[model samples]
Target: MCLGDISARSQDQMILNLQGCDIPIHESQDFKDFSEIGTGGYASVYTAHWKITKTKLAIKQFFESSTKEIKEIIINEIHLMEIMRKKVIFHPNIIKFYGITKLKDEINYAMILEYADGGTLGKYLRDNAESFKWENQLKFANDIASAILWLHDNDIIHRDLHPNNILIHQHSIKLADFGCNASSIQLEILKGTREMPVSATNRIFVNLYKECWEHEPEERPDIDQVILRLNSIPKSHFDSKENEESEIIDELDLSDCDVQLYY
Candidate 1:
């Protein structure tokens, strides 16, 4: 996946459906007239409407390239979403998926998602940078923590949980993107009257990032654990050298959002 190969790969994504797969394709009726909302390292976001449902949706269209392993990743993502659709289960601060596209070998993959009105937390922070203080930061962290905890409690690891991954809608906080979801972290289970400790399983994520990016995936922090860490840091947290604004923003702490599993 050299830079030059991107163009050719992106063309496949322009396909509305994969033929012969009997995949249900919902091409944006106004595809040619939709608004480009944003772009990511590998995808483009658009605001589109579903004619049958007459509902608004956010479309994340990925660029084409055989190098990215997420094709299977996206396929698995859809399956995981289908299974975990209710995992969030009545939580007001999480985003919901509407549907998914069929898999393909020669085209860009797309996922239909529930659109957020307030935009990414990063963008909002920048826009209101001067006004964001400990009050807003703490509130945002609490809301996001609740959503993340819900995901972890359900046994799903959202490998990417940075500020950019957060979608805010008025008062609600929605966590988006699950391309790197890992296995569930079940509670210590009872097996034949014997108890086993998977404490390392809980620490798997930390292994992914204990030292700078210790990135020892095996040691990454789970949601329940993250809740404890976030709570331990006081709401008035501030590093004198970092400045008041920087300190507050710094404390919301997406510093360890990116984690990898260790061997």
Candidate 2:
């Protein structure tokens, strides 16, 4: 079947259960309060507190007025998350998925997720430019590579793997904002503006970066190979005094890199 035919079939199979059985509809009282944290083309993210459990959570809300096409895309995204939740199991580098909620007579539907207190990796890199040493960059890159390897082993392609979609929590990296089908190489190109730290110019790091951005998808190294290469790099390279004091490039322009969720 053509790609369009496959997509059409997938959308046709998506059925939303309004009865709070599979995915519950949480009442407003369940959450103490919600504050907007971020916004994408199809949904808005809010940080909410669970009244009884006293747990902090991230909720992505999708409006009801969205077109059928957009709703299908959202459903596909949710389906992909569910697949990962069941198949890949849990990994430290993968974002945790809670559940979905839809209120009665409300146009808003929400998907509850784990809240990363430290925010996106892109933001962390920018804010800590002075302190983002080579050692830390290597750690973050390894975390991301491990997560991608897990996803690929489960037969799922992230399709969107940029710094902005990589969240930081407790100084660790977690991959997020994926599901739609796209070119992996193209996604890397989209991340060019984020650029590697000056310290990453080491021969080993340079080779891995080039392999990741290879134009031919098949020519690109698998996440496992990428991880192996990253692990092979000498720790001393990152420990050099020059790398420690290297100035960070503060020219990241994210305006053009605003990737829409489920696009």
- Best candidate according to lDDT: 2
In Å, residue 111's CA in model 1 sits off its true spot by 1.0
TM-score, candidate 2, is: 0.79
Off by over 4 Å in 1: 1-27, 30-33, 52-54, 66-68, 86-90, 101-109, 181-222, 225-243, 246-263
lDDT (tens digit, per residue) of candidate 1 on 6-91: 23335333333334333234544433335677665556777777666666778776666423455545555555555565444646
The true-structure Cα RMSD of candidate 2 reads: 5.6
Model 1 residue 228 lDDT? 68
TM-score of 1: 0.59
lDDT of 2 by residue, 82-173 (tens): 66665545888888777667544555467778888888876776668677777888898899888888888888777766666788889999
- Write down the RMSD of all candidates, one decimal each: 11.3, 5.6
Positional deviation of residue 208's Cα in model 1 after best superposition, in angstroms? 19
Q: Looking at model 2, which ten-residue stretch has the lowest summed lDDT?
A: 1-10
